[model samples]
Target: MKIGLYFGTFNPIHIGHLTIANHLAEHSDLDQVWFVVTPQSPFKKKSTLLDDHQRLEMVYRATKDYTKLRPSDIEFGLKQPNYTIDTLTYLEEKFPEYEFSLIMGEDNLKSFHKWKNYELILNNHNIYVYPRLSKGKIETQFNDHPKIHHVDAPIMELSSTFIRKSIKAGKNIRPMLPEHVWEYVDEMNFYK
Candidate 1:
């Protein structure tokens, strides 16, 4: 089995996120796209993040109907300050029969070198990168890696930060998220 881990904060799961997962699952060789809900991301500020379990629940509710898409709290069980390298190592050992690959955006690709043990991650795992508004060509810089492939995952111009701001401003985020997710967000006061 081949699995692509799509790790993110997912403060509230949105339609844009689901579109990309569906796109990858339907078009790529990957059998499933696991939304690895991070307990905390090393790169992003913790203050900007919501509670991990809450975010995971939102993800679960949003993806409940799609078997190819699932939510995970794998990082909660890992050491503090989750690192992609460490998670990859743990997953590889625990699920030896399944091949794991990373799914990320081109925006993240620019800072790829900053990750812990980036060289090991590059050598051992395959990466599927999607486009973002970020500039520059990823292939020009990372094309040397044998296990890397660029994907065009459907993305909205909007981001989680923007969505939060919209909610705070009493703006409608109807297009930014699916109905169920919006209902959950309103009910739980997430991003409030």
Candidate 2:
């Protein structure tokens, strides 16, 4: 199976995340898109960040209805402050028959060269980049790189930070999240 890994903290999974993942799954050659819920970095703990399991639950609720989308908690067990290269390597070993690719925003692609062992990652897996409104010049080396594919997906400017802040401000951000996720957040009183 060809899988696209969409990694994020997903403090609270929202529509923007679902739109991009679903679009990639339906429009691209990928067989499925996995929302890889990233665990919080032990070194840089943020007060607003939910527990790893809580974030994963939100992801699961957001993606439960989509056949081509699912949630993954692979990074929860890994060491803190894990690198993409390390996760890719671990997934590759765990699922030898499956081809894994990365799903990232254009902004991340701009700084892709600075990632650890980026050359090795480029050589091993494909990178599917979606559009994002951000300021940065992409590395010249990646402009025409075969391993990197710039997918013409819809631009998603909504962010978890914005949602969290909105909730804290007593704004009805219910429309931003999946029904189950919204219920979960409401019940838990998260980000309030």
Candidate 3:
């Protein structure tokens, strides 16, 4: 199986996340796209993040309808400050038959060098980068790389931060999330 790992905090899964994953799964060579819910990203601040289980559940609810999309809690059990390289290595060993690729945005590629063992990741796996709304574009250095495939996915401006802020401000976020997810958020009173 050729799997594309789309890792994120998913502070709450929204339409933008789903659109990108759907586009990649349909257009790319990937057989499935796994939404790896990161409990705490090594580079991101942890203060504003929701509980790991909450985030995972949101992802599960948001992606449950897509046959090609899967929600994963793999990072939840990993070491604190979960590193992509370690997670990738473990997945490779555990699922030897599956070839894993990375799905990220052009924004992340801009600071790709800052990640741990980034070079090893580039050497061992393929990277499927999608366009982001604010990010300028992918750098020229990786634009032509054989291992890097730039996808022309729709640019969605919706973000989890924006959704959380809107919710706190008593604004409607129904347009940005799936119906089930919106109901789940309301029922759980999350992001309050």
Q: What is the C-alpha RMSD of each candidate to the true structure, in Å?
A: 1.6, 1.8, 1.3
User: Which pairs in model 1 have colliding backbones?
Assistant: none
lDDT digits (tens) for residues 1-192 of candidate 3: 899999999988999999999999999899999999998876678988988898888889998899999999988788887789999998998899999999998888888888899989999999999888764655656777899988999988788999999999999889899888899999999888
- Which candidate order results from sorting by lDDT in descending order? 2, 3, 1
Q: Per-prediction TM-score, please?
A: 0.92, 0.94, 0.95
Candidate 2 vs. true structure, TM-score: 0.94
Task: Output the better candidate (2/3) by TM-score.
Answer: 3
Error of 1 at 23 (Å): 0.8
Tens-place lDDT digits, model 1, residues 119-149: 8888888899878765556544676668888
Candidate 1 similarity to native, TM-score: 0.92
Over 4 Å off in model 2, which ranges? Answer: 41-44, 134-140
Q: How many residue pairs clash in each candidate?
A: 0, 0, 0
Candidate 2 lDDT, tens digit per residue, 74-166? 998888789999899999999999999999988788778889899999999999999887665455569799998999899889998899899
- Order of candidates by TM-score, top first? 3, 2, 1
